[model samples]
Target: MDWLLKATTPAEKILVMFVAILLFAGVMAFILYVSEKLPRWIPAVGFLLPAVIMLAFGLLWPGLRTIFDSFRDAAGRKSVGVDNYVTVLTNPDFQIILLNTLAWVVAVPLLSTVFGLLYAVLVDRTRFEKLAKTLIFLPMAISMVGASIIWKFVYQYKPATANQTGFANQILVWLGLPPQQFLLNPPWNTGFLIVIMIWIQTGFAMTILSASIKAIPDEITEAAQIDGAGSLSTFFNITVPSIRPALIVVITTIAMATLKIFDIVRTATGGQFQTSVIANEFYSQKFSQGNNGIAATLAVILFVLVIPIVIYNVRQMRISEGER
Candidate 1:
C-alpha cells in the first residue's frame, strides 16, 4: 500500500499502472461472468455497479474532499471555517482576479461569437468561402499553448531604439509610435490575453454558426428579398433568427470555455501583472503559493459560477431538440 503511493521512478510508475489495468480487467471479466449467471434485472445492476463505483471514487470523492479542504487552514490542520471564502471574495488582490475573470467571461464569448457570425455571414456563399473559413479556423486547430506562444511573439516588446521583432510593435514603429509593453501592464495585459482566447474561440463559433446559417432555407431569404429587404435587413431579421439556438449554444459554450481558461494566461503572461483568471489563480494558489485552502475555495467558486451557464446551455439544447 505504501509502495502504491511512492512510485516516483518511471519504471515503478509504469509497473503500478500496469498492475492497476490488470486488476481492472480481471474485475471486469469476473463481473461479466457473474452477470451472465445472474437474473436479467440483476445483470443490469451488475453491469452498472462498476461504473457507479468508479464515478463515486473518481468524481464524487474528489469533489467532496475539495469542498472539505476549502474549510481548512493553509496548513490543512486547523479549521478556518469560511475565512478562505471570505478572503477570496473581499480581498483587493483576489477581487482583481475576479474582475479579470469577469472581463474574460464577458469579452471573449461576445467578441468571438460576433466576429464568427459576421465572418460566417460574409463568406456564406462566396467563391473563397472554404479558404476564408479555414484561415479563421486554423487557430482553433492549434493548441492554446501554441496559439499563446504565437501571440506572445506578436506582442513582444523591445526598446524603441532597437529593431522590433513583434508584429504588433512593428506596426506601431512603422507608424512612428513607441513599442508598448503588452504583457507587463495591468488591466490592458488582461485584455491582450483575452484577445488570444477570442482568436482561438472565434473559429469554433464560426464553424458552428456557419453550419447553422447554411441550414437556413433559401425560401425564407428569397421571401425577404421579395419584400424589398436589404442585405442587412435580411441578415438581421431572417438569418439571425434562423440560427438563434446555435447562437445560444455557441455563446454559452464559449462562455464556459472562457471561464476555465488557463493555458493562454499561463503561457502568455504567467498570470502575473493582474492578468490572472480563476483557473490560473487556482493553480498559483495551490502550487506556487502553497495555499491549499484558498485554492480549494477558488475551485469551488469556479464550479458554482459555471453551473448556471451549463444549466442554461443544457436547457437551450433540450429546447432546440424539442423544437426539432
Candidate 2:
C-alpha cells in the first residue's frame, strides 16, 4: 500500500500499472466465469457492476463534491451559501470573461462552419481536391496548445524600430504600419484568440460536412441543375437542405469545443488583457487566486451551460436517425 501510495521510478510505475491491469482483468474474468453458473441476470449484473462503480467514484462522486464545495468558502472550511456564485456572476472582470466566452462560442462555430461548408462544396470533386483538403485539415492534426504556440509566434509583436518577425506584424511593417501587440490588446484580443480556434476547428467541420455533402444523393443535385438552378441556388436549396442534420452536428460539436476552450487562451495570453474565458477563468480562480469556492462555482456554471447543448445534440441525433 505504501509503495502504491508513493511515487516510484518509471520502471516500477510501469510494473505496478501492468500488475494492476492484469489483476483487474483476472478478477473480472473470474466473476464472469462464476456468473455463468448462476442465473443469466447475474452475468448482466457482473458486466455492469464495474462500470457503475467506476462512474460512481470517478464522475458522480466528484461532481457532487464539487457542487458541494461550490457552496463552501475559498478555504473550504466555512459554508457561504450562494456567495461564490453571486460574486462570479456579478464581478466586472468575470463579466468580461463571460462576454468573451459568449463571443468565442458564437463566432468560432459560425465562421468555422461557414468556411468549412464553402470549402467542402468548392473542392468536392475538383482537381487537386485531396491536396486542398489536406492543407486545410493540417491544422486539425496539431494540438490546441501547439496551434496556439505556432500562432503566438505569428501574432508576436516588436517595436517599429526593430524588424518584425511575426507574420501579421511583418505584413504590417511591409505595409508601412506600426507593429501591434495582438494578444495584449483588450476587448479585441479575444477575437484574435477565437480566430485560432476557428482555424483549428474548421478542418474538423470540413471533414464532417464534406462527408455529409458527399452523402447527398446525386439525383437530387442533378434535378436541381436540370430545373435551371444556378450554383448558389442549388447549394442553398438542395445541398444545404440535404445536409441539415450534419450541419446541426457540426455546429453543436464546435460550440461544445468552443465552450471549453482553455489551452489556446492559456498558451497565448495567459488569460490576461481581458482575454479570459470561463475555462481559463476556472484555472485562474482555482490555482492562481486560490478561490476554491469560486472555482467550483465556475465549474458548475460550465457544466450547466454544456447540459443544454448535449441534450439538444442527443435529440437532434435521434430525430435524424428517425428521419433516416
Predicted model with the maximum TM-score: 2
* Candidate 2 per-residue lDDT over residues 50-140, each given as its tens digit: 8999999999999999999999999899999999888988989889999999999999999999999999999999999999999999999
TM-score of 2: 0.94
Return model 2's CA RMSD, one decimal.
1.8
Candidate that would win on lDDT:
1
Clashes of each: 0, 0
Candidate 1 residue-wise lDDT, 1-324, digit = tens: 665779988988998999999999999899899999987598998889888999999999999999999999986888898999999999999999999999999999999999999999989899999999999999988999999999999999999989999999999999989899999998799888888999999999999999999999899999999999999999999999999999999999999999999999898888888899899999999999999999999999999999999999999999999999
- lDDT of candidate 2? 0.93
Residue 220 shift from truth in candidate 1, angstroms: 0.7
Distance from true position, residue 115, model 2, in Å?
0.9
Clashes of 2: 0
